[model samples]
Structure formats: structure tokens, C-alpha cells
Target: MHVRTWADRINNLREINTLRNQIFVGFTLTMILVLVFAGAFIYGEVSVLLKQSAEKHIQQTAIQANGRLDVLLKQIDSLTTQVVTDSYVQKLLLKEAKGMPSNFNERQSLLQIANNYMAYSSGISSLELYTLDNRRLFPLDDSSIKRISMNALTQADEKKGRIAWVGIDPRVSDSVLAIRRINLLDNSYLPGGYLVVHVYREYFNMYESETEKEEKNPFRSRELMLLSDSEGNPIISDLDDEAAKSVLAQTGSTVTLEQESMLAVRQQSKVADWKLVLLMPVEAATEGISVLRTAIFVSIGIAALAFLLLTLPLSTMITRPIQQLMRSMRRARFGGLRVIPDGRNYFRTLEINELNNTYNQMVTHMNELIQVVYEKEITQSRTELKALQAQINPHFLFNTLEAFYWSLEEKEESELAQTILAMSGLFRYVIGSAADNDERVTIRDELEHAQRYLQIMKMRLIDRLHWFIEADEQLLQVPIPKLIIQPLVENAILHGVESRISPGSVTIRVFSAKPGFATIAVIDDGVGMDGEALNKLMQSIEGVPSQEPKKGAGVAMSNVQRRLKLYYPNTNERGSGLQIDSKAGAGTTVSFDITIPPEGDGLS
Candidate 1:
């Protein structure tokens, strides 16, 4: 049931076009393609390796089988040599028909000789002698087909010298037989008799028993057979037509029997011309490969399952987030803006979550832009209104002050007229300008403004008030903030010299103090305040803005400090703001540094 359900789901997937389905299908198809190519490669490689291994194993078996057969056959051949050279056998074979003993006597003599040699024989168990006149002149036992085999052996043209070699014959029953001719001592016309040795076939059978015991294979069986190379011979075998034809034509290493579904490995006998062939079924030859095939099937299934299990969920994790992002984009295309589905822990990857955060921030910034535009419109309206008022006020104030100055001048009130003119210029210079306090002015402008204010105050106390202004001509053109020096000079006149009886001297100095900077100091030689007053002034400059008049005696000085901070702004590193030093009845000095050799762009 589960298998059927999986099959149904797989069949249904071909009809769907969704992202997740597409991703799953593409990944599955790719894995299947790789596995299919790999399986074909593995199949070919494994089959070739097994077949070559089978051939090598059969070659070794042929060698080993031939070795055992050769050792026994060699021993039998050696025995034949020893028997032929024996004096007793020679005497029995050379005896003429007239001089030959009676049958009983001959039997006794031959038996004695045969027994002597047979005692030491390795494979042969019987020896028989035949005379030219008799079919059997032997003291040994023979098989029932003696007459037929003797005639066959006697007529064989393979006879050489007084003796000759024979092979494992097909006609005779499971034995090797040889014949020897006895020649006259001095003549060559006729031989006296023949000697025949019969070797039992039990030695060959012993090899089969050993081969079976050593190899206990039950999957397939093998058989060993010896076949003569003679024509018109009768022998049965499992060899198919191709193998049989090759073995008959010549010796070879291996042949496949298609008809019998078998394989043959052949070895030619060195002792004779016979052929030894080892037959094995094709089914048995591939038995090991069948087992490997089963294992490969199991492994393939396991590997496929493992591959899907490990990668499927991971691919979905990656593709799922991308799919969700696409859906959000699709919604955003229709609507104004749509937020992607997201939370703090929305994604397993921190990078994905960060992307979500940046997208959200972009949206937030986009929404804030609307309010920013409205605020900008209101600010623009107020700036225009202020611009209109600024255009009218300074002109009216300057004209009215000019009229008062001329009236005072016509009455010979030159000092008073000068004061009015200076005041008028101060008002017009400050109010008529569009530049703010933070904007840059030349040192020449700031110093001249301070001098005008001092000149106005000097008229009130002509005897006690004295002042000096000193500045480097080159430093005069450097940028400074407007009204900064004038306010400090005003504070010194009212607060430093207001109660002093001695002629007080106020000095304004400007000069380069370090690389890329210039200092401006205002000094008043009046009765200086105590430590408490100086500390309060310092606190007010530090932005405390003290409300008590006694502790906050420096509203103008504090304002100057704030302006310095706004203009210079490096309080911690460069000591740019106001520095104050005072002693009772001695003096008070307020000094500050501004960046010099200005970039000239200034604070526009």
C-alpha cells in the first residue's frame, strides 16, 4: 500500500508546475542520471573482472592437473625401461622355438622373472610375454580381450628398435599396454618373441578423488577426462562442437562450449599424445558474479535512499525561503509595498535574516520620506517670511540712527555723534547681513567690530578706560566667526572694569600660536574675581547655564564658549574653546584658538 501511494505521488508530480515540485523533480532527475551512468560503468567493470578471474583460475587448474598425471606416467615409462633391460626377460624373449622349454617350464621361468620385476614396479602390476608362434607366452594375468589387443599391439607401426611406446588407448579397459620385440643376437631376419607390460589405470583415478576432496564446491561440478587423438575413436565428453573440434585439430588453452553451456581448459600429455580436458558449466563460471549482482542491487537501493534523505530536506530549506521571497515580490507588484513574512528567527541562516532586516529598513525609510517632505515645506515658508522681514528692518534702523547722528554732529557733540555712528554701523553690519554666526568672517571684520564696541564704552569713562588692539597683518584675513570677539570684549568692559578705580587697560591680541592655528585673547587689568566666581564662569561655559547671577556672572562669556565649540569643535584633542585665568586686583584673560590658513570654503 505504501509503495502504491508513493508511485501515485510520483505520477502526480509530472502534472504540477509549482516551485517546490520543480525543485524536487530537477534534483531527483539529476541524481537518477548520475546513478544510471555509474551503474552501467560498474556493471561492465565488474563483469570483466570476474571473467578474467575465472579464466586465470581455470588455467591454474589445468597446470596442476597435468602435473599430477605426468608424474605417474613418467614412473610407468621408467619401469618399462627397467623391465626391458633385465637379463631374465631378455633370455625369455630370445629363446628359439626348438630350444625353448616346455610350456610348464616356460611358465615357471617367465613367472619368476615377471615377479622379480613386478615387485619393484610403481604403476604396472602385470607383465606378459608373447612368442612369434603363440598368442600368449605369459606368466601374468591378462584381461579377457587379450587376443584382440595383442594383434592390435603387434601390428602397430609405432614399434621402434626392439621396443616401442604406446599411449592411453581407448579400446583397452583402463590400462596402459606396451610391446617389445626380441631380435636374434647376430641376425635381423626374425625376432624370438615379444614382451607386453600391462599397467593398471588406478593411478589416474586417484587424481579425481583428490581433486574432489580438495574442492568442496556444491554450486557446480567439474569432470576430468583423457581422450586419445586418434581418428574414428569412441569417447564421450561434455565438450561442445567448437571445443571438440579445436582439441582434435591442435592443443589450446581454453574454449567455451555454447551448446552444453560449459567451458573447457585443455592440457596435452607429455608422456603420450592424449589430451586432458577440464569441463565446467557456464552457470558455475558466473556463480560468483551472481552473488555480486545481488549485493549491488541492495547497495544501490540503500545509496539512493541515503542520497534522497540527506539532500531533500536541505534543498527544500534553501528553495523554500526563495519561494517565499518570490511570493512577497509578486504581492508587492500588485500592491504599493508588501512586507515579506519574517521574524527575528525566521531563517536558520543569519545572512538571510539580515537581508530581511535591510529590506524592512528600506521600507521604513521610504515611508519616513513623506513626513520629511511636509516638514521641508513648512520650514521653507518660515525662511521666506524671515527673509522679507530682514530686508526691511536693517534699512529703517540705519536711516533713523543716521538722522540722530547728524543732529548731534551739528550741535558740536562730536563724541556723542561718534558713538551714535558706531552704534548705527554695528547694527547694520550685524542685522543687514544674511550670514549666520556659524558662517565665516575675516579676522579684520571681527576685530573692527570689537573696536567699535570698545570705542562706544570708552566715552563713559575717559580717564579710567584705556585699550590696545594688536594683530598680525597676515592673520587678519583668516576666517573667524562673526561677533565672537566683540561679545567677549563687551563682557570684559562691564564685568571686569565696571568698579575698578585705576585706569583699566583692555587689550585684544591675535597671532599665530602653533602650526595651522591662531589664538585671540582679551585682557582686562581690573579688580579680578575670586576662585568661586572663576569656577562659576567655567561651569557656565561648560553648558551648565547657571541661573544665579553671582555664580553665572558670564552669560556673554558662556555664549562665547558655546559659539567657540560650534565653530572650533575639538574640545578634547586640540583645546579649541575658551581658556580663562584671573587673579584678584590683577587681571582676567580669556583666550581661545581657531583653525587658521582656512580652507576658504568656510561654513557657508
Candidate 2:
């Protein structure tokens, strides 16, 4: 039997391993294929987009280079025209044509004029003047004399007339080579001596300084070059000479050439009949994109690793419970009344355990509901009995008082009329038409009721009784619970003054405490209570004992305590604002500090 169990266990293990292997293999293949296809698609699209972007970048560079070249050419043309028409140059040309002798003093004056012009013109290398007659050349410097001839000047002035500008000469070594002639007028007559201005190439170089200072990405490799009129001939570059030459030859509408893994942009400038080329390498342009791609691949790898680690455990947890339930249901043959031992040990899910607990709790609550119904019925019967007892005792006492009043009247006892009248008033107040159902009365009404009760008791112990009532007029109108003050006064009369043999006195005082509370205190000069009796009185007042006999002073006192608790359960510490202060053989005071409920809080 043990051998058979081992074989079955081995078979189960093999089956589980086979199932796990198939699931893992299928999931890994699907994820890998999906990731590969997505990566390929993204790479292809990004490559095409990057290429188009590079082309656009080159086109924009070309446009900007062309605009800058045009601005420089216009500025140069304006400067040349201003120099040739300068007043000083016109005066010098006029002086030379007047047949003035070629003396040192005359040459000195012309040289001074040329120096003044050079000061104002930033790129003027040399200034020269040639005459139609070969008498002399003024300010005859070495550079000016090297390439000067009388016929050459006359021919230049004839071919390109007044205000005409000649093209840049190859023989001139300056960056910018241009010459312009000004025809001198002798009192509105044209002269033969021409005013010539030679502007140097360094003027264009000054503009290059402004370009270098403009902000550009420092990481990008850039090249700026000047091309000769032979459109493909490269002259000078800010980068490698060989690279500049190669870049110039490839210039077209737009072109990008790959150098290893880097891309270059070739842009041309056609202003001044010269090409300006700019080359940028690609590695700098796509550095951010490469970093973004690397981050995406790293994130994918982390997610794949986490998924692999969590799969087997998550799958087992999900399937284990269903497998157990299926096995149990099969063994029981799907019978309803079979005892399926609580499966808390067999199940690992908290939700399933909680569901079972809730079902058990529902059954328990149903049983408790039935028990609550019986307790409520018992409580109802007790309430009815208490109500009946309250009614019988009050009615019997009122009837006895009425009979005694009639006997006194028959005997013609006129002196007892005030006492009898007081008795009648007391009975009327206690058994009055049930209070307005609001359970509250003004302090004036409550005090009046207490006075009538004292008057009736005064008649029974004539001449031995004394009482005083003092209350603030403002507190008299404040609302308090109906019989809240009366009970304490009754207790003072029955327990303090009545229990003594010597002549006793009772005093009732009412006063306003704060804005929302009133105080009614009953004090007696009769023998006060001992500690034991006081303890019993306090316990009875607190309703500590529910048994019949132990409820001190019978229904009236107990009912008052109950009503106070029911009405204001949260009143002060001793309950209902009722407080007792006494010492044996000393007077006792029972005070009711009643809170005046708000005007609209069911208190009329």
C-alpha cells in the first residue's frame, strides 16, 4: 500500500511539472515575439523619421546661410558707394586735375586726405587717384604704384563709367576685393581724374566674428566655409580643409552624407557669387533619442523578470481552491445534507473564509432576534403595572382629603378653611389635567404647587410649622421639568421637618444662576440625616436598587428620579441637577439646579 501511494505521488508531480513547463514556454515565446516585433517596427519608423528630420535641418541651415550672405553683400555695396562719393575724395580729384605742380607739399595734402578717409572706412587697405594725363599719381604708395598705369585707369573709367563697381580681382589677396570710381566735376563739368576706393577683405571677416558669437549647440561639430565662383572649388574653411572641399563638391538643393555612424549637412550660399557651407555631425543630434531607447529596453527587461518570478506562485494560488472544491464535491456525490467540515484549513483565501464567517453570523443573529421579542413583552407588562399603581394611590389620597374637609365644615371649624382650601389646591395641582404633554412648566408654576403642599401639611401640625419662599422674578418665568422642584421640597418636608418632634422650619429659595439655568433649593431646620441614612437616600436617588422595598420613599421619589434620568440623562454628575447637603442634628438642604431648556425645545 505504501508503494502504491508513492507511485501515485510521483505521477502527480510529473503531471504538474509538465503543465507548468508548457505554460511557461508558451507565455515566454508570446512575450518575446511581441516585444521583438514592436521593437523592429519602432526602430524602422524612428530611422526614417530621423533621416527626414536631418534633411529638413539641412534645408533650414541653407536658407539661413543664404540670408546672412545677402545682408553682408548689401552692406558692402552701400559702404563702397559712400566711400567713392565722399566729399574729401571729390575735392582731392578736382585739385589734381587743375594742372597743379607735382610738388611734395601737394602730395602731403593728398596723403592727409587719404588718412582721414581710412579712419572712417573700417576695411579700406589703400586709397588711390589716377589722372587722364600721365603727369603724376597723388599719394603714390608702393602697393598703389605696383599695378597702376595711365591707360589702365582711363580704360576702367570708360568701360565702367561713373558710379560703376568692378568685380573682385583675382590678383587682390584681400578677403573682399572691390573697386569703385567717382567722376570729379569742375564746377559741374566732368574731369579726367577719378576718385577710387579699395575696400579690403577684412570687412567680411568682421561679420564672421558676429556669427561665431551666436549661441549654438556646443556638442555638435560644425564647419563654415567660403566657396569660389567655380561652384565646386572650396577656398577657405573654419574646419578641416579636406572635409570643407569634400562638403562643397556635394552641395545641391539639400544633401546628407553618412560618415561612419555620423550624418553631415551640406548647405550653400550664392550671394556675392560665393557659396557658404555648414556641416553638422549626426551623433550630437540623436544623443537624447538613444538614451530614451536604452531606458525603454531596461524597463521592459525589469517587467519581464518580475513577471517570470511571480507566475507559478500566482497560478497555483488561483487554482488550488477550485481543485479542492471539485474533489470534495465529487466525493460527496453532490448530496445536499452531507456534513462538509469547514474548509478553513484547506483554503488559503481570506475572502472565502470571511464569506463562511458571515453565513454563520447571520444564523446567530436570527436566534438573538427571537430572544429580543420575549424581553420586550416582559418590559411592557411591567410598565402597565407601574402605571396602575401610580393611579390608585393618588386617587385614594385625594378622596381622604376631601372627606376630612367636609367633616371640618360640619363641625363649623372656620379657622381650618384656609388649610382645607390649601389641601384642595395641592390635590388639584398634582392631579391636574395632564401637563401640556411637553413635560415642562415655568418655575412660578412649580413653586406654587410646592407652596400648596406645604400649606396642607402645615394644617396637620398647626403653629409648630414655619416656612419662607424667596425667588428672583426673572427665574420665575424660566422653564424647568414639571415636578423637578416639587420632589425635593416633598423630601425636605417628609424626611427633615416632619420626622422631628421640636417645632420645625422649611425654607424654599429659587434664583437665576446663569443665562440658561435656574436653582430651586429646599432647606429645613429639623433634625438632619445620619451617614447610613444619607447613603441609603443617595442610592435610592440614583436608582441603584430595582427591588420594591429598597426603593426609598416609595413611588413618588423613585418616579421623580426615573423621570429626571429619562429626561436629562446627562445632567451633572449626581444625576438631574439634584444635590443633597446635610449633617446629623444640623439643617439639611435639597437643591434642584434645573437647566432652562431652550425656548423652542418642547418647553412651553
Candidate 3:
């Protein structure tokens, strides 16, 4: 009977598992289908937005290009007008009308003037004069004047004194040469000769570059072409030769260029019959529409997926308190300790809710215990720090007194005695005993302390050093950080002045730096650091880690930096900041600016 009962139980358990597996599989397939559709929709929408942004950007770029092109056209027109009305051209026309001898010198002079102008303007390729009376055209050459047939000029109407920019010559050349006619008469106005200047292609290229700079967008590529006539036969093109020819064949008010689906807008040149064609790729021109299509598809796919895969399961899981507890616990490892929600009857699972309630109660009790321990530890740390400070105070006081005692005992009479007294006073100020005294001590007192330190160092070095302290009397009483000058002096003596063979001198100068600041510099003439060593020294002064400390020196310098930070925390602009200037073989200068805070404001 027991064996039969166990078999029945096994069969029931298998059935339950099979049902759960079927439900999970069905749910997964539904979620995946929804996600796929949603993804497509979101992708479509994003594509649309991107294309629209691109189109707007291109349109603005095009407008800027057009403006620049307009400016270039105006400049060209002005240059042409100046050339036409030039005095040299008028003199040549007058001389030709007077039936004067065909003087070679006079002709040569006129050619030189034209050549000079052409050289100055880099745009003019050639200058020609058409004499109506002679029915001849004179082309200016480097050394001689050549006469050519005036057939092209005969077609030009001079009766109205109208200036004409002729269309591009199909057979003779690819350049667009224009003519301006002036009437010449003796005392009475009559039709005279015409002067023509051929513009170089480089002129147009410069204008194109200027326009491109003004536009400043890289994605939208642009092509500029100058057509020979209004009918659009190519004269010059920024595009490939084949593309230009194909585009010319499709000439219209707005033609779509062949080979590539690009939109071309025709702009008639103001000074000539040539047409300026602006072509933009069709993909670029209608980017907005394409992007919209893509974005719509992507957005729809995302929305569907979110509803199926994310919303349904998340909603069910969120309602379960035990599941919420598990998630919160995982988050706590990353420092996100949060309260777990209480489960209601509406929740899908009752057992999970009961589990969550038990876990929350346990967590609450543990949190109170942790908080008490954390507070106690912090209190203990503060107590220990106070004890350390107390120990440091007495030790420093003992050292200062011992130094003072030795100075008196050794019979160091003059400056040495004064320096020791200053050292004692400085120690008193630092230890809080001198709080009732002037918070702002004289620069003179600071220098005395530095001098004292130097005296002690001189004892060690046996008079191998000299120091100069120079300051204006007015600056002596300006407030400064206590002991600031001493360390800098010590640094120079130990690292700089002492390192040299010859007797070296250290100079301390205090001067006005800028408004609200004063300058203090320690300069030493000794073997200076190389660039790399100087850099390391600067890093240490700025409190950046350096290899020098591991090699075991620079402790005093590091301590100085720490004390500066503690006393003048707000004064340092960016943390760990200091400046040092030095060159190898040349000495180093260490300088810092001190801004005296208002009276009784303390170091910062």
C-alpha cells in the first residue's frame, strides 16, 4: 500500500510541473513577439527624427552658402566696373579715335597697365580692346600687341552703350569672357570701342571655399557648376565630368541630376549669361520623410514589447512582497537600502507576502543595532584624535624650549639669540597661547623666524650659506600664514643652496603682487632640478604622490603642503595646486601669493 501511495504522489507532482512549464513557455513566446514589434516601431520613429534633424540642418547650411555667394558676386561686379572705367583704357580709346600714328611705345605702355591690373586681381585671365572704327580687336600679350578679327565684337550692340556679359564660347574656350562698351567722340558723344576682361576659374573656386566655410556643416555635400548658357551646357563643374554632362542634359528650372537622384537649383549669374547650378543629394533633401517612416516602425515595436514582456510580469512581481524583499536585498549590496512594501490580499501570492513581512521586521531590528554601533565608533574615533592632538602639543612645546635653551647656553649672541626668541614666539602662536596677541603678525616677525631657521641650518652647514631678506616697511606688518616663510627658506637652503659647491645665497622678497594679494618668493642660486625632477618636486608641493617620498626625503615639504591645506583650505583654487619655475643649471624660484584675510578671519 505504501509503494502504491508513493507512485500516485510522483505522478501528481509531474503533472503540476508540466502545467507550470507550459504556462512559462506560452508567456515567453508572447513577450518575445510583442518585443520584436515594439523594437521595430521605436527604430522607425528614431530614424524619422534623425532625418528631420538632418534636413533642417542642411537647409540652414544652404541659406548661408547662398548669402556668401551673393557677397562674392557683388565683389566681382564692382571689380569689373572699376576695370571698365579705368583711365588707361579711356586714353587708348581716345588715341585710336584721333587717327594718331600707331605708336609702339604708347601701345606698350597701355599693355603694361592692363597686365599690372590683371596681376593685382588674380581673377582676370586676359584683357582685350575691340576698336569699332578699325574693325579690329587688340589682345594684350607679354611683349607685343596682337590684332585679331572683330567678328565676335560685331555681334555686340554698341548703339545703346549697353554693357554685356557674353555667354560662354563653345568652340574658342571654356572661360566666360564679358565685354563693356564705352562711347568715344570728339566734343560730342559717339559710340567708341569695347574693352573685355577674361576672369580666371580660380576666382570662382575661392568663392566656393568661402561659402563652404560659412556653411560649416560636414554631412551635407554640395556641388557647384557654371553652365555655358541659359540652356545649361556645362562650362565648369565641381562634380565629375560625366556627372556634369549628364546633369546639363537634364536642364530645367529644377532638374533632378542623372546617375544620382540629386536636386539641382538653377541660379542665373547677375553679371553674365552663365547659370549657377546648386545640386544636393535627394537622400539628403528628403531625409526627414525617410526618418519618419523608420521611427514610426521602431516606436510601434517598442511599445508592443514593453506591454507584453515588461508591464505584465513587472506588475505581477511588484505586487508580491517576498519578490520585492529579494530585489531590495540585492540592491542593498550596492548601498541602496530601502524599505520593502507590505503585500495586500490583491497580491498574486499569499506565502510570498508573509515571507516579506517577516524579513522586514528582522531588517528593522538589525538597522537599529547597526546605527548604535556606527555612532559609538565615530565617538571613539573623535576621542582618539583629541588624544593624539594633546600628545603632539606637549612634544612640540618641549622641542621649542630645548632649542631656546641651547641657543642661550652656546652663547650665540647677536642675531642667533634674536632668532631663537622669534622661534619661541612662533611656536607660542601656533600652540594657541598667543591668541590674545595680534592675529596679524608683521612680515618682519616672519622673516626673523626664517632667519632663525637659516641660522640653525648654517650651524649644520658651517657657514656655507648667505641669505637676504628685503621688504618695504609698509609690507612688514601685512598679515601672513605663520611659519610660511621658514619652510620655503628651509627648502631652499637644504635642497638648493647647500647642494652647490661654492657658497650660495638665498633671497627672500616680499612685495605687492596684485590687488588683494601679496607675493613672497624664495630664490636660491644652486644646482637646480632638471625638467623631470622639477616636475616631481612640483607634484609633491601640490600634494600629488611622488617617488621621492618612497626613496625617503621630502617629508618636511609634504608636511608643509598638508599644513597649508588645513589652514587655508578655501584659498587653494583647485585642490593640490602649486607652481614652480626652474631650469637645469639655472636656479629655481618658489613663489606663492598670500591674500590677507580680514582681521580675525583666521587663515582662510
lDDT of each: 0.69, 0.62, 0.63
Q: In candidate 1, which residue ranges exceed 4 Å CA deviation?
A: 1-15, 36-40, 95-107, 121-125, 131-136, 139-174, 180-193, 206-259, 338-342, 345-604
**For all the candidates, what are their Cα RMSDs to the real structure?**
15.5, 15.2, 27.0
Cα RMSD for candidate 2?
A: 15.2
Top TM-score: which candidate number? 1
Runs with alpha carbons beyond 4 Å of true place in candidate 3: 1-76, 134-162, 169-174, 185-187, 206-216, 220-228, 240-242, 249-258, 284-303, 310-345, 348-604
Worst 10 residues of 2 by lDDT: 161-170
Q: What is candidate 3's lDDT per residue for 66-159, written digit by digit as tens?
A: 5555555556556655655667666667777776544556666767677666665666677776665643334533322123224435434532
Q: On TM-score, who's better, 2 or 3? A: 2
Can you list the residue pairs that collide in candidate 2? 175-201, 176-201
* Model 2 segments more than 4 A misplaced: 1-141, 145-352, 367-438, 498-501, 527-586, 598-602
Candidate 2 structure quality by residue, lDDT tens digits, 19-131: 44656666766776777677667866786677677657755765666676556556655655565566755665576667654556655776876676567656666666655
lDDT score at residue 155, model 3, on the 0-100 scale:
38
Reference-based lDDT, residue 226, model 2: 47
Cα deviation of 54, candidate 2, in Å? 16
Question: Which residue pairs in candidate 1 collide?
Answer: none
Model 1 scores worst on lDDT over the 10 consecutive residues at 228-237
